[model samples]
Target: MSQHHAPRQYLNWLASLGLLLLLGLGVELLLQQYGLRQQQAEQQRLLAHANEVRAVLLGELNATLHLATGLASYIPARQGRIDTAELEPWLQGLFQQGRYIRNIGLAPDNRIDFLYPLSGNEAALGLYYPDLPKQWPTIQRIIASAQPRLDGPLQLVQGGRGLIYRVPVFLADQRYWGLISTVIDFDRLFAEVEAVARQRGLAIALLPLDAAQQLALTSTPDTELHLPVFLAGANWQLQARLLNPQPPLLRGLRLVGWGLALAVSALIGMALHSQQRKTSLLLALSQSQRDFLQAFELAPQGMALLDAQGRLLAVNQALCRLLQQSPTQLLQRSVMQLCVPAEREQLQVRLATLRFGHNDSWFLQLLDGQQQQIAVECSAAILGQLGSASEVRILHVQDMRERLRLQRLQSEFTASVSHELRTPLTAIAGALGLVNGGALGEVPAAMRELLQIAQANSQRLQELINDLLDMEKLLAGKMRFEAREQPLWSLLQEAVLHNQPYAAQHQVQLQLLGPPCQVAVTVDGQRLAQVLANLLSNAAKFSPPGSSVEVAAVVQGGHVRVSVRDQGPGIGENFRARIFSKFTQADASDCRQKGGTGLGLAISKELIERMHGRIGFDSVEGQGSTFWFELPISVTKPQDAST
Candidate 1:
C-alpha cells in the first residue's frame, strides 16, 4: 500500500513547489516591467524640464542683445571714438528697466570709450578688449566677421561673473568701427533658471561643447538628461538630472495585493488537500501493516524481532535455516547469546542505543548452536518505543563475504600489472640512453635525433609505471608517512634548486620568495618535495619562453600556504573540472607534445591529504594560474636546526 501511494504523495509535493515557483517568477517579471515604465516616464519628464530651462536662459540672452541693438543706433558715426556724455543717459535708462543687465559700453578702436553705471565698473573705462588673452580670439572673430557675438561667465577686471555680448559697429560710410558691448551678470541669470528647477525637483548644469573652454557651472543630480543648446551660434549642453524620485505607491500596493491573494488561495487549497491526505494515510497504514507481515515472513535475508530487553520474540524461516535451528528454539535465545563471546557485550550496548531510534548498521559474527560463526552485517530499527515493557525492535542481517573477496582481487591485479611493466621499461630506457650518448661509437647526427626521441619516450614510460605504483599503494593503505616538523623556507629552497635544471631546458626560471622568518609545519619532507617538483614541471611546461615561475610561502589563517605562480596560458573551462583526476590532461595532444603521465596532481592531492593538508588552484583563462597548498602549523617540539 505504501509503495502504491508514495509516488502520488511525492507528485503532489512537486506540483505545489512548481506552482509557487511559477507565481514568484510572474510577480518578479511584472514588477520589473512596472519599474521599466517608471524609468521611461522619469527620463521623458527630465528631458522636458531641460528644454524649458534652455528656453528661459535663451530669452535672457536675447533681451540683452536687443538692448545692445537699440543703443547701437544712437552712437554718433565717427572714426573709432565714442561720446560718453551723449550715451550715458540712454544706457542708464536701459539698466533701470532691468536688473540683470549690468552695464553697456561702446568701444571704438578696441578701447572702451563710453560706459554707464561707472561707479562699480570703473576698472573697465580704459580697458582694451583684445588685451585679455582668454577672449582675444572670439573678439577678433567678431571684428573680422562684422557679426553679433557672445563670450564669458569670465572673471571680470572688476568682480563677479559676466557674460559679454558684442555687436560690431559700422560708420554710415561702411567703414569698420569698433563694437557695442553689454555685460550680463550671470548670477542673476542662473538664479531665474534655478528657481524653476527647484520647483520641478531637478538639478541643472551648463557645459561648453568645446572641451578647451573654461565655463564650468554644475549642480549635483541623481539621473542625467543632456540637451543641446545653440547660444549665439556657439554649441553648449544643458544637462538636467532628476532629484530623488519615488516609485508610484499604487503599483507597490497592487503587487502586494496580488501576492497576498496568491498565498491565501494556495493556503485554502492546501487545507482541503491535507484533510483528504489524512484519510488516505490512515487507510494506507492498515494495508501497509498486512503487506509488511507477508514480506517479513518470505524475505530471503535473515530477519528477527526482539523485545526491548533484547530477547528474541520471533525469527523468519531464513533465520532458522541459517542458524540450523527451529523458530521455537531461536525464540528462546537473546541477541547476546547468538553472538561470539568477544562481540556479545558490545552488541548489548549497541542494542540499548539501537532501541532508542539509532539506525546505524554493525558488523558482527553470529554463532550457531554447534559453536560455528557466520560473518554478517546487521542493521536495527525501533518498531515500537514505550520503554522496556512495550518496546520492540527489528534487525536485518546480510552476509558480506563475496564483496570483501572481490575488493582484494582487484587490488592485487593493479599491483601485479604495475610491477611487471617496471623492469622492461628500465632496460629499454638504459639501452636508448647508451645509444644516444655515443657509447656505441660516433653515430650519424640523423640517427642521434631518433635515439633521443626513443630515449625520452622510454623515460616517460618508466615514470608512468612509477606513478601507477604510488597510486596503488595509496589506495591499498600501504603508503607510509614520516611527518616531522620542518622549516618551510628550507623546503622551498631545496625544491627550487632541484627543479632549476629542468626549468632551464624549457627556458623558464624558478624563483623563491620566502617569509621574513622561518615557519615550521608537520609534513613528510620527501613527499612534499615531490609535490613541489610536479607543480614546477607543469608550470614550466605550459609557460612561454623567458618567463619565470614564482614560489612563495606565507602564513594564512592558522596554516602555512606555499604557492607556485606561472605566467602561462591558464587552465581551460572544459578541463578544469577533472584536472586533478588521474590520467587526465587539459589537451591530450599536450601529453604527446609536452610529455606527462597526468597522474602528478592526483598523486599530490592524495599525499597532501595523508599529511592533513589541502591543495587548490586559482586560474584565469588567458592570464595565468596559482596552485597552492596549506598545512597546519606544527604543534610538536621543534627539531634540531641541523636536521
Candidate 2:
C-alpha cells in the first residue's frame, strides 16, 4: 500500500508544473503584444509627418512645370513650334520666376534641340544635343502623341543644379509640335521650406536623389536631418520631417512606455478580478432578462419591429393575442397584408413617409384568423441604420377594434334615424301639396296659414334627413370628395344670395365682411356653399328682429376663415360641447319655433372636416355665438403673375 501511493504524489507535482507554464505563456504574450503596439505607433507617427511634406514636394514640381508651360501661349503668331531664339531670351528673363524654374529648353525628334541657358550662342541652340537617353524617349513620345512630356534631372549633365520639365507645343489650331522644357534649381527651390523650419527652431534640409542616392541638395554647413526621404524618380524625392527627434525626459517614450506597461499590468489584474465576479453578475442579468421578457409578452397591446418598407421583423405574445398570429407567421409580413386591400394602399403611402426618417401612422382594420375585421392603430418610426443601407424602422401597435366598433354603431344609428324620417316626410309633403293645389276646397284663412307652416316644417325635416344620410356616407368613406380652387369672394357672394330669402323670412340682416381680397382656397364649391348656407341660415334664424347677422371671410396666414355670427342670445357654455352632436340642438325648444331638424350643425361640421377644414364655435352666454370654420388658402400665385 505504501508503494502504490507514489502515483498520487507524481500527479500533484504535474498539476503545479502546468500552472507555472500557463503563467509564463501569458506574460510572454503580453510583452509580445506590447512590442507590436509600439512598432505600429511609431509607423503611424512617421506616416503623419510624411503626409505633411507630400504637398510641398509636389507643389515645387508643379510650379516648375507651369513656368515651362507658360511658353506655349507666348508665341501666338507662330505655327505649332517654338522659336529657339525667342524662347531662350524669354526663359532666361524668367529664370527666378517661380520656386524651381532654373532653366528652360525645347526638345523635338528624340533630342534636346534647344537649351534656354545656351540661348546667346546660336551655334549651341540646336547643335548641342543633350544626347541623354532619358531625354530622347520622352521627346519622341511627346512628338508622336502631341502631348506634354516631363523629363527629370536624371543626374544633371556636368553637375547642373536643377530639375527639368518638358512640355509639348501646340498653336491655336491645337496642332502638336516640339517640346519646351525647364530645369528648376533644387537649392533655391526648397530655400523657403528650410528657412521656415530653421526660423521655427526645426532642423531642416532639402534631401534629393543624387546619382540614384539620397543626398542633401542644399549646402547645410553643420546641421543634420534624421527625417526619411522617398524617391519618386531619378531627380524627385519626398521626405518626412519633424521638429525634434529626441523628446525631453518627461516627454520621452521610455518613461511613457514604462508607465503604459504598469497601467496595462494593473488593467490586467483588474480585468482578472472582474472576470472572477462575472459569473454572478451574468447570472443576475440573465434572470432579470427572463423576468422582463415574461412581463413584456403579457402586455395588453401588440409589439413589433418594422423595416422601412413596413415589413414586420418581430412580435410579442400581446401581438399574437391581438392579431391571432404567431411571431413566426408575422415575420416578413407587410402592413398591407394585415389590412384590408382597400386600406392597404393608404397604409403603404403613410408608411412611405418613414423613408424621410419621419414617423408615420395610420389606423387600419385587419382580418383576424377567423376572418373577422379588427381595428388597430399602428405608428411607425425610422431608426436609421449605421450607414448606407440604413432604412430600418420600429412599429408600435395598439388594438382599436372596440373604439371603431362603437363609432360604426353610432353611424348606423344615425343612418337609421335618417331612413326612419323619410316615410313621415313623404306623407306630410304629399298632403301639403294636395292642400296647396286646393283639392280640399275653401279652407279658412288661419287654416291656410297653419297648412303653410306645416309644409315648411316638413321640408325642413326632409333637409335634415338628407344631411344625416350624407354624413353617414362620408363617415363610411362612400362619399366622393371633389376639390378645386374657386374665386373666394365670388363664391361667398353666391352663398349669400342663396341664403338671402331665408334671412328675410327670419327678419335678420345678413352681411359679408372684409375687403374683396383675391384669395382662393381649395375646396369642394358645392359642398362648401352648402356649408355656408347652413351656417348663414342658422345665424339668421337665431338673430333678433332687425338685428344683423354677420357672414365674414378673411385670409390669414395662408388660411381662409369664414365665420357667421348671430346678434342674438349666444349659446350657453354648458351646451356648447354637445351642440354639434347629431340630433342635439342647444335650443331644443327653439327647434320648433325655428323649424329645424337639428342635424344641420353636425352635418356641416362633418362636411367641413372631410375637406380638411376645422369648425368651431366661440360663444358668450346672453351675448352672441360666432360659428367659424377655416380652410387652407391656395397660395400658389395665378399663372399670369409669373415673373
Candidate 3:
C-alpha cells in the first residue's frame, strides 16, 4: 500500500473510536439518571409504608391509654372509694371494648386491691409497687407529677411481655389516692403493625428514645427512613427499610446500555438498533398498564371510573358484587341509575360539581340488581385536568350495612346495661339511705360516716347511668318531649333552689342577678329543668371558693337568653372545642379535681336543641366563663292574657 493511503485509513479508524467513546458516555449518564429516579421512588414508597404503620401504632396505643384514664376517673367521681360490685361491671365493659388490653388493675395505696379478668392475671392481683424495686421509682415520679405515664414492654409476673400505663388518682382535695395500672399486650399490638408493613415488603423497627441502647420491637438493621412516634407521653423512633433493597431491572438496564453503546460503533446497525429500542419501550409500557389493571381489579373496596357525565367507564369485580350486577350490565350505565330515585337528582348535581374539581363524599342508598336498597358511603375525586375531555372521576363506595348494624347493637347494649345497673344501684342507694337515716336502728358514728359515703356514691352512679340512657335515647331519636307554655321565671327559681345544696357542698354560692320578668316559653318543663340544673351544678363545681354563680335572664330579638356566669379559672382555648364532647375533660387531672362524668353539658345541649333553643359559651383563660342558652318566646293567647 502507498504510505499516504495508509495514513488516511488510520485517521478514519481514529474518528470512529472517538465517536464510540462519546456514545458510551451519553448512555452511561442516562443509565445513572434512571437509577437515581428508581431509588427516589423506592425511598418514597418506604416512607409511605412507615407512616401507615406509625398511624396504626399510635391509634391503638392511644385507645388503650384512654382505658386507664377512664378507670382512674371513676375513683375521683366516687370520692376515692371503690365498690367492687359496681367496679367489676364497669371494668368488664371497658375490657370488652379494648382490643389489646391484658388486664386492668386498681391499686389503692400502691397495692393491687382489685383486678378485672382475674383468670390469667391472678399472680399480679396482690402485687405491691414497693416490692418491685425496678418500677417503684417510676411510679413515684408519676404520682409526684400527678400525670399519667407509659412504661415497659417488660416481663410481667403473669409470664408475658406487656406495656404498663399508670395513672395517678387524686381526690377532690388534692390527696393522693393510689394508682391505676393498665397492662397492654405488646405482642398483639406490634403483630398488627408488623403485618401491615410486611404486606408492603417493608421491615420496621421501633426504638424507644429513652433507652440506653437501641432496643427495637422488630429489627430492621439497615434502616432507610426514620419517623417519630409520640404516644402516651413517650417518645419512640420508628425506622423502616425496604425488604428488597436492590432493583434487578436497574442492573439489567446498565448492562444493556453498555452493550448497545459498543454495537453503535458500526454505522450500518444504527437504524436496526433504534427499531429494537422502540419495541422494548412499547413492551414496558404495556406491562405497566397490565400491572395497574391488576391492582384496580383486586382492590377490596368497590371502585369505579366514570366520565364527566357520571357514565361508568370501568368497574372492578367488587363493585359488580356490591351492586349484584354483571359487568356487561354495569358498563356504560349512568351511576345515578343505581341510586334510589329520591337521591338521584341530588347525586347528579353533586357529580357535576365534583367534575369541576370540588371533590366530595356523601352517604346514600343504592338499589341492587334485585331492587333492594343498600346504604353506602361514596367518595369522589377528579383524576385529570378540569374541563378536558380526558378528565375522569373515581368513585369509592363502602358498604354501611355492617357499620349501621354495629351502631344499632351498641345502642341496644348501652340501653340494656344502663337499665340493669340502675335497678341494683337504686336498691343499694335506698338501703344505704335507710341505714344512714337510723331507720334500721341507731348506727355508730364511725359506721354512719361510711354508710353516708356509700349512699352518696351510689347516687352518683345512678345519675351517670341515667345520663348514659338519656344520651342513647337522644342519639336514637327515641326521646319524647312534652312541650307546653310554661312561666320561665318559675323554672329559674326552682333550678337555683335545687342546686343550692350542691353549690354549698363545693363552697360556692348561687345567686339570681336580674329582676323577674313575665316571660313564657314553649318547652318541656322537665327537660328544661334538667338543663338548668346541669348548668348551675357545673358553674358551682368550677367556681372558686366563696365565689358566686350568677343566673340572669334577658330578652333579645324575640328570644330570651338565660346565662350562667362564673368567676373561675375559665376554659383553656385548646379544650374549649371539645368541652361538649362526651367522655372528654380538659385533662385527666380535671377529672380528679372536678368530679364529673363529662356528660352534663352534652346532655344539656341535646335537650336544649330538641326544645328549639341554642346553647353556647364565652370564656377567657384567666378571667371567667359565661354559658348561655336562648329560646323563642311563646305567643300569648288572648284567653291567657285576659287571665
Q: Output the lDDT of residue 267, model 3.
A: 50
RMSD per model, one decimal: 23.5, 23.3, 19.1
Which 10 residues in a row give candidate 1 its minimum summed lDDT? Answer: 213-222
Cα lDDT tens digits, model 2, 37-121, are 6655555554444445555556666666666677767644675456666666676667756645645666554355656566332
Candidate 3 positional error at 184, Å? 60
Prediction 1 global C-alpha lDDT:
0.81
Candidate 3, residues 1-643, lDDT tens digits: the string is 6899899989989888777667767777766787777777776777777889888888888887876577777898999888999988878888888889999889999999788889999999999999999999989999999989888787999988898999999999999999999999988888888998898888887776645323544333333767777676667788788887755343444454555655466455777799899999999978977996798799998999888889898899998999999989999999999999999998898878874557799999999999999999999988863233466888889999999999999989989999999999999999999888889899998797888889988988898899999999899899999999978888888899988999999899999876775678999989999999988988899899999999999989789999999998889988998988887766557338777777889999999999999999999987889999999998883122213
Q: Estimate every model's Cα lDDT from 0 to 1.
A: 0.81, 0.69, 0.85
Give the lDDT ranking, best first.
Answer: 3, 1, 2
Shift in Å, residue 71, candidate 2: 97
Candidate 3 global CA lDDT score: 0.85
Q: CA shift at 371, candidate 2, in angstroms?
A: 11
